[model samples]
Target chain A: MPSILGFGACLPPRVVTHEELAERLGVEPGWILEACGIRERRWAQEETVVDLAEGAAREALSAGGLRPGDLGAIILGTGTPQRQFPGVSAELQRRLGCPGIPAFDVHLASSGGMVALCLARELCRAYGPVLAVGAERMSDIVQRDFVKETAILFGDGAGAAVVSPAEGPLEILEALWAADGDFASDLCLDSGGPLKMNGRTVIMQANRKLVATVETLLARAGRRTGEVDLFVFHQANLNLLRQVARTLGVEASKVPITLHRYGNTSAASVLIAAAEAWKEGRFHFGSLGLLAAFGAGFSWGGMLVEAR
Target chain B: MNTLDDIRALVAALAQAPLPEDPEASLFEAGVIDSFGVMDLVAQLEARFALKVPDEDMLPRKFESLSKIAAYVASRKA
Candidate 1:
């Protein structure tokens, strides 16, 4: 796998606090915190998914010290693409003025983000530089008048990573994932329909699988949980995060949390949180980290990376 | 013998919250554990009892109380 050229994240201009969501839904705002550990999330009032992706992709390109023309391919992992066909990757390619690059989309909800990162690493062996983006308009999948569980649990955002052969800050050590489609009914979003989830099933399955994957990856790499400098987990629920930390005996300081502020942006959550850590210098040089994400297909993934 | 005592300990650990003194008391009714916690308890039960708690048997009713969990475990072990 090639080095990670850059990391970037973009959030919408509009902020929807739990108070605002509660006021609109006529429910207590406190429940949002108690249930999911989110106080606020973003909603793209006028920005389309491509617009968010464009911003993040631009930032990632600039951070990597490359032009859009340097990109050989664009892979977008999105759970909420505005259109069914011709995903945001194609639109992002046009917006970036990279006309002939091979652009495609990977749809796996949250895990798609990590899957894109791993794929970009492999693709970099062939393509010069691959841009991997995880963008989602979870707010769009959630209808306000629908189930409050789904409504208050989503936000809008995008995150991008530039994977290139040129040595950069982060190096990939290992990446692995697994899925069980039998539980597909537990979390489903029908065409032109609001997102529905058996929240408990998602929480439990995600918790178990994510933890196991992290352990398996760590064991495979001959690393211990204590050696991990950072834990970049898919920002789903705060309670779930805490439980994972407890079960794994990982300290709170080892985790970078964005769910509390951004809610669950699905595919965008991990990248957003990782980008935040990078900005704060937490995901710094010599930092060994564990990356994990889970989503709808009952897919769970884990990746190990170290910054140099 | 009932697996009630073992199941009770598992529930307490999973919830990380207080459990009622009554073995027959409902964890859900007492808000002691949510559905996720119930699954966690199931996972622990499977590991401790050396049994595979099938996905179809993951209903909350099967693990609502210590008594229910014990009976389910015994039947599976049998």
Candidate 2:
């Protein structure tokens, strides 16, 4: 099984607090905090998605003690690509100077990063080392005037993880993913348009789907939920994550939440949480961690890992 | 567990807002409960009654107001 060798994350310098957004939107400052549990989020003033991705990738590689040439493949997960042609992964590969190995992008919306990790785990079976990065500049597409909910719920950031077959602290145990297209319209952003979301529907569906998918994954893996040392859920909503944790009977403290600091960075969320937690020494040897996410496609997935 | 007053109190507590005394008022339209609030209501109902509300049962109609939630809870209990 492939294991996570190292992880890294990068947030834009500009920090947009809820109070600032609330003042601009003419809403009570506490409303944003109560509604989304987001106190502050980062916005990219001039940095591109590629720049954030490159920075995170470099940090992960450095942490893993590997250079660009050592990577066997690059997998980029992002919903907000700078261009449709020539996916973000290709440019990232070029910038990282890893020209030969396979590189591409996967768009599972918020679940993109976790799905890329699942794919990278499989790729590691054949290739020795894989770099999976999820980067998004959500501020580029958000409409502050029209879509207030989504406007406040998104930020710009990127996260990367170096996965390889080598014995490491985080071993990929199992991965499970599923989607219900019937709810696709619940959250969507058409090209040349601002992101639109049925907040209630998305919340309900995400809660139901994430809970069910995680249960199934745990059952398939034959691991109890109590065995999980850390639960890194997508940083979509803080209250939603807490509700899901309560439903799953997992303690609130065990789940690492980054939504307050970074908002919902979409594909970068779970990986960002994982990287931040790892950096803080949250995972010890033999500790088990679970990562789960729900996104626009009504896509949801979970990955179980054991720290070596 | 079976009284409307009890149900109303639960709804008010979970919603963190007061509901109109009228049983037929639209909670959604009145801004008594939003989408995320609906989730909390469901979780509270499930925990309070030890009943699992199916995803399909989370319709707006089922939770329209205090009376509706009480009726729905009764139906699920039955």
Query: What proportion of the real contacts between chains A and B does each prediction keep?
Result: 0.24, 0.44
RMSD of each: 2.9, 2.8
DockQ of each: 0.38, 0.45
RMSD of 2: 2.8
Candidate 1 has which clashing residue pairs, if any?
none
| Least well predicted 10-residue stretch by lDDT in candidate 1 chain A | A140-149
Residue A212 of candidate 2: its Cα lDDT? 84
Q: Taking the tens digit of each residue's C-alpha lDDT, what string does model 2 give over B12-77?
A: 886646688798888887788877788888888888888999966656678878788888988988
Alpha-carbon shift of residue A189 in model 2 (angstroms): 0.2
Clashing pairs in 2: A169-A308
lDDT of each residue in A195-298, candidate 1, tens digit only: 77876677767777778888988999898999899999998888788888877889998988888789899888888787788778886778798888999888
TM-scores for all predictions: 0.90, 0.89
